[model samples]
Target: MESASLDSRFSKPMLDGNRSAGSLEESVSPKPLPVDDSPSAPPKPPNGGFVAWMQVAGSWCLMFNCWGIVNSYGVFQTYYENEMLVYRTSSEIAWIGSIQAFLLLFIGALTGPLYDSGYFRLLLATGTFLMCLGMMMISICTELWQFVLAQGIVVGLGAGCLFIPSVAVLPLYFSSHLAFSIGVAGSGSGVGGIIYSIAFQQLQKSIGFGWASRVMGFISLVTLVFPLLIMRVRSSNPKQKRKVRKLFDSSALRELPFCLFLVWGFFGFAGVYMPLYYVGSYAIETKIMPPALAFYLIPILNAGSVIGRTVPNYAADKTGSLNMFIPTCFGLAVLSFAWIGIHNTPGLIVFIVLYGIFIGAFMTLPFSAVVKLSPHLGVIGVRMGMLCVICSFGILIGTPVGGAVLRQGGWISLQSFGGAALMVSTIFIIATRVAKVGAHPRQKV
Candidate 1:
């Protein structure tokens, strides 16, 4: 999801001993002045420096694997539907991408705690191996189940392991310009999508699917190594796992604004990727463009996202993340409907570009919104993790459901279904904002 919430993403890692969160501010002192938490680390953060920015760089690399690959699965969806998995329905093939996306986020509940327990290096090495191994296995896969197993589960879990730590450590380093830093790192999702889509699109035509997939895997393995070397987070004693709480901690879910935000995410995300997963296939089906040109849509959308992810976040830092986030959700809802009107080549391209910008902002803002909306510092991780997990379920069920709709209702219905879902999601997102800040339009919230 590349959901970049701060200490909710970063709080625990900043302290000297890697002391778990929640009790730190209280255990060390009863003083009302918010001066000290753990004596082991400095009272203030090293907000800007070479090392701090490198963490951003490493996270950018991680986003390439975590979401870049997931977003580009549209190319695979088209290829599988046309060539490899003709026996399968679009709904059936979508499970591969859906489950891949699901596990990448679903396991956040577990990975978040384990990372806090000082398992960073172990998770990184193991995740990188699994990602490369899964891609290699994809090269040889002949069956639908094989693709699902290799790409869906193995690679999904590997990304999940790497993802939590990628966003988690950022808070320990920065404070004032946190959202901008995360936006830069988060943009890697778009960067990865563009490169990987182009790689597979060009290579598979020349070398065939097996080697094309393996080449992507090779890139994943090599590029991933930089993050392993450059990213450095000191760990706590494995035994003293203080402050680590579970992702779906029950107490956090009971909050109204948080729960409402979860609703917005679930339905909004359900419709969000419908276009991304199906646009290429739609172009081919409608004959608006040949397969040659249709292939570029994925890369083009991702290319637009390169700006969408960073620019909106930079703006959000001033306007407030959710302040910008709510309108972006509305833009996505509008674009999903506008996609229905795009019949000609230019219109389709415009649709893709606008969708890219809106969705990129949509994908980037949630973690920041969650961080600000949290009731207190102690449970930010709990709240943010819950938001991510619930949203993962939405991503899991969304596109396959769209495929089923596509099967029954045709493209108009498919577009309508996606649009309607986003509208509902937009309503809920507005409700969440209103609930948080009482419909005060002038207020920055």
Candidate 2:
């Protein structure tokens, strides 16, 4: 086409052995537009620098408050069942945490488009306020309905608002280090989990549940201040200049690989929170660990996750997110079975740590995989929000189902169920990779 266009503009087909008079005349009459061979390129991400890393730091703070508190639900699960909500069965108590996790992911689906529309600060501030308020509300609650409203509904909504921006912001700042940066920011969940769980554990003993909850709220209020101040969109010009996306766009669902990835996330996460919610209770009930020491299992698990989120994410930058994610899911499946057999403190601790690491890898890498599945950068937030919709349901049912399984058929059935969910997840992730990149193992997806 380029050759034909140039020929038509610069010259006409000539009679045999004769130069076209128009060719020579046409060349001097008007010059044709110059053509460059290469297509125009999009601007590159900054990849690294002061402002970019500052965004990462702010994102880390956001994550600390969002996922961090969610991860600490186990501490509350233990405390409530033993003291406050003892009248309720384990299955019933599990609903509070599951609902909390559910609403965080479900409501997040609506706010992703809002984030793209330059409502980031508004989302963050509203979320942080609700988070602090929910914690304070939790401090005052004695009834089941109050706990659900305060911790499950209010805190969950706050978390949902913050979730997308904390994650999606990194793509604007770093490309090569995207997984690693996300991993680093994501480690805040682990660190946050460890601190909050321990804080609640110690404080509840000395100050009672009400003051303990208030102290945690104060901590959330303080930590969130940093993110609120430093975080900004990558562009000085508002993203509101772009068309705002719809709240319920599921266009990515039309793609086969994405659908398969959603299945992978759904079943995989269905089992992920089971141990986190029940490990403390399981340890004490079975006499595998001392009662006083059992609550530490959550912190131990999160500490492992801090490492899991980091090293595997660094490796994912090299090996590909789907590749790293498949094996991690497999490890979690294996560890779920391993969790069923522990009879001693050392064994329980080992299971907790490994579970934490694998689940941490599972949590962070899936987002990267979702981003890779995205057709373009512009739709990543929406795609991520969609992914969260699938994952949130998994989280919603995971713990309560485990509690029901525990009540009905004992730990064996509960552990087996969790393992099977993850096994299916691993298989589908492998399928997602094959669908995306075909049978070539060496090629990056």
Candidate 3:
């Protein structure tokens, strides 16, 4: 009885000490600390553990399978025009890609919030099923509306599901190594573009359109398995409650940095994909290249882009995203207006190679900039979703506008339109910089 009483007496204080330790750990940890103090805490060590990096690589492969084929839609454009949708106008055909790009960005408005609320597994699985289904369906499509439903809507929705979740989840896994992780993931699009471009080109000749798309569908199925297996959320903090108490926060939109970035998002997307839609067509029309050779260039450009995406993102993490982004914007503008506008054979080839490099880098850096601009992990999804909404408008309209320009004056009109769009985009980028300067002028390095 005396020993039992002694044990009971020891257990009380042990419980109390454990409670106190829990409280103290929560107070000291980086996550629960105040926002003002977060920057002061030493940055998280690059804890890109093997499992974490593996997940990033897996996400990369998944993205290549889903969004990469979207990038290679140019090859399909050439094939579909001559074969399947022969009656469709170039402008009409352009909508297939436009709708696909539109869904990818527009759906993010909802998916981003869903992701922030912690439904990642559901989202990834649903996306994989939709993407595979869409690719398989596209093989059987013959009419314009059918293509729209299969390729445009279904594939677009799937891309949306896959793309944003991969991006949103990366920050949860790696804090200091965020850029490196994202850069690696972003390259999947480039690699996908190359692989799909070559595969579709060859399969179109050997097995015909139906089998060609089926091959892509099979490849997508294989690629998607990794993300389902490996990609996981690791943040310790609970998800931000998306209740009526927090439905809308207009105050966030008021921030100058976010507003400026919104404009940058608009301009950035407007010019980025114009080349993708036209490069193959331009190559064939110029008489210096065969249709097959021209289609192969998309992947070649994407190959260069793999380097472009990775290198610039590493630099952005060091030098500020805006610092890396401005020069790339200027490079794209110059390449589009001057080099691409003027070149015939050699100039077009050189322009595509150089432009692909800069544009790929440009695409990767913007997301890092968004994360830096809004450090509140809770709001990252909403902020990025809003940005995507604005950017979607640019993407939706940019290609149609390019198509209109092409119809009016042919190649010269398209070059001028692309060039002018880039210039306008650069203006917004500069304005973003000015806003940044004004917001933190006295703050020193």
Candidate 4:
């Protein structure tokens, strides 16, 4: 009878690491002085001592150096066009960054699951080494394929590893304030973008491309220390080793929320990169705007994005993720169709701020929504990887499409393309709502 009861209790999926009692008496009655079930206790919340916060801060620093620099690649787009890769079309140059972004999301599919099973140290070390090596190697590239392999493949993979581990490990440290912590940590991208933008611009002129990239590579090494020190995974069931296999789980794609998320990602990328790719060029083409000012706005947009990313994440935790996400999508659609279409100085600035905020919210809220919709925390990496696969399709298509529209109809046509894409995002946001309703008729906001 005791064995049967124990088996029944252990069979419950939610009780995977928990103990079960045979009866009320077994649960609460006083036992012999030597009786002990301490080994079966659930994992405790991390103490989040100074060391914990330090770890979080360190993760942010690494993210800033890697993912943050990835976000700021727009600054280099114009420079590469004028100097090194003059033969490449604007669309082709855009592909380099697009692939970089695509890989950042695409590689997550495998890394997420690997991380869940307890390869945190291995993953972080691999990402750090690859990223530093890729940056250093990129300094010598003078052709398209070299850039593609070094920047597109290697750096993309490194950023992908960095992204999943940083996000996944944080939950183990802070459960209640996860959103806030993520927001604070995510701000690293913005800070990194600003620093690199300034450094790359100044150093490209003073130190040359090789040394500028080498300097950034050195900074990446300094930022990797936090992940080395603070990341930890507390296993609830030590006897159960995390089984490793091919990490991509296609089954997650069938779920309605993830499908809607893919649609959202496609349109989201289609709209977000329009400004990133075109803003400086647009400013230069107008001839009235100075080159320095045009270069200055990219980082400014990213600075606003830092705030946009953090604040909406905090708000989404209070409000519903869907509620925050949908409105931001609609707002971006409006900013694209309306403000960017105007083509004047004031109109362009307004579009930049509006789009930055919406994109910031878009990035933060979607991950939160994915987590909320997932059936189990253990599979978050897999689910996130699946989401990235979908998102990569968007990144792959978005900028080149925008560039094509610009070629065919000029700035006006590009704005129209952005608007249309954002409208598609709004449609998907509505689809998400419908999917939620179908899943739970009486579900509250």
Q: Tens digit of lDDT per residue, candidate 3, span 392-439?
A: 888888877787778778877787777777777777776776665544
> Model 4: runs farther than 4 Å from truth?
1-42, 237-239, 244-254, 376-379, 438-445
Candidate 4 lDDT, tens digit per residue, 221-259?
778766677666555567755555345555566778668
lDDT by residue for model 1 (55-107), tens: 99999999998889898999999999999999999999999999999988887
* Worst 10 contiguous positions by lDDT, candidate 4: 24-33
Q: Which segments of candidate 1 are over 4 A away from where they belong?
A: 1-11, 14-38, 41-43, 234-242
* lDDT tens per residue, model 2, 322-365: 87887898899899888777888888888898889987888888
Could you tell me the lDDT of residue 248 within candidate 1? 62
TM-score each candidate. Answer: 0.91, 0.88, 0.85, 0.85
Residue 336 in candidate 2 has what lDDT?
Answer: 89
For this target, which candidate reaches the highest TM-score against the unseen true structure?
A: 1
Error of 4 at 146 (Å): 1.9
Show the colliding residue pairs in model 2: none
What do the candidate models score in CA lDDT, each in turn? Answer: 0.81, 0.79, 0.71, 0.70
Q: Ranking by lDDT, best first?
A: 1, 2, 3, 4
Assess the local accuracy of residue 7 in candidate 4 as a C-alpha lDDT between 0 and 100: 32
**Of models 1 and 4, which has the larger TM-score?**
1
Top model by lDDT, which number? 1
Worst 10 residues of 3 by lDDT: 8-17
Regarding lDDT, does 2 or 4 come out ahead? 2
The alpha-carbon RMSD values of the candidates against the true structure, listed in the order shown, are 5.1, 11.1, 9.3, 6.9
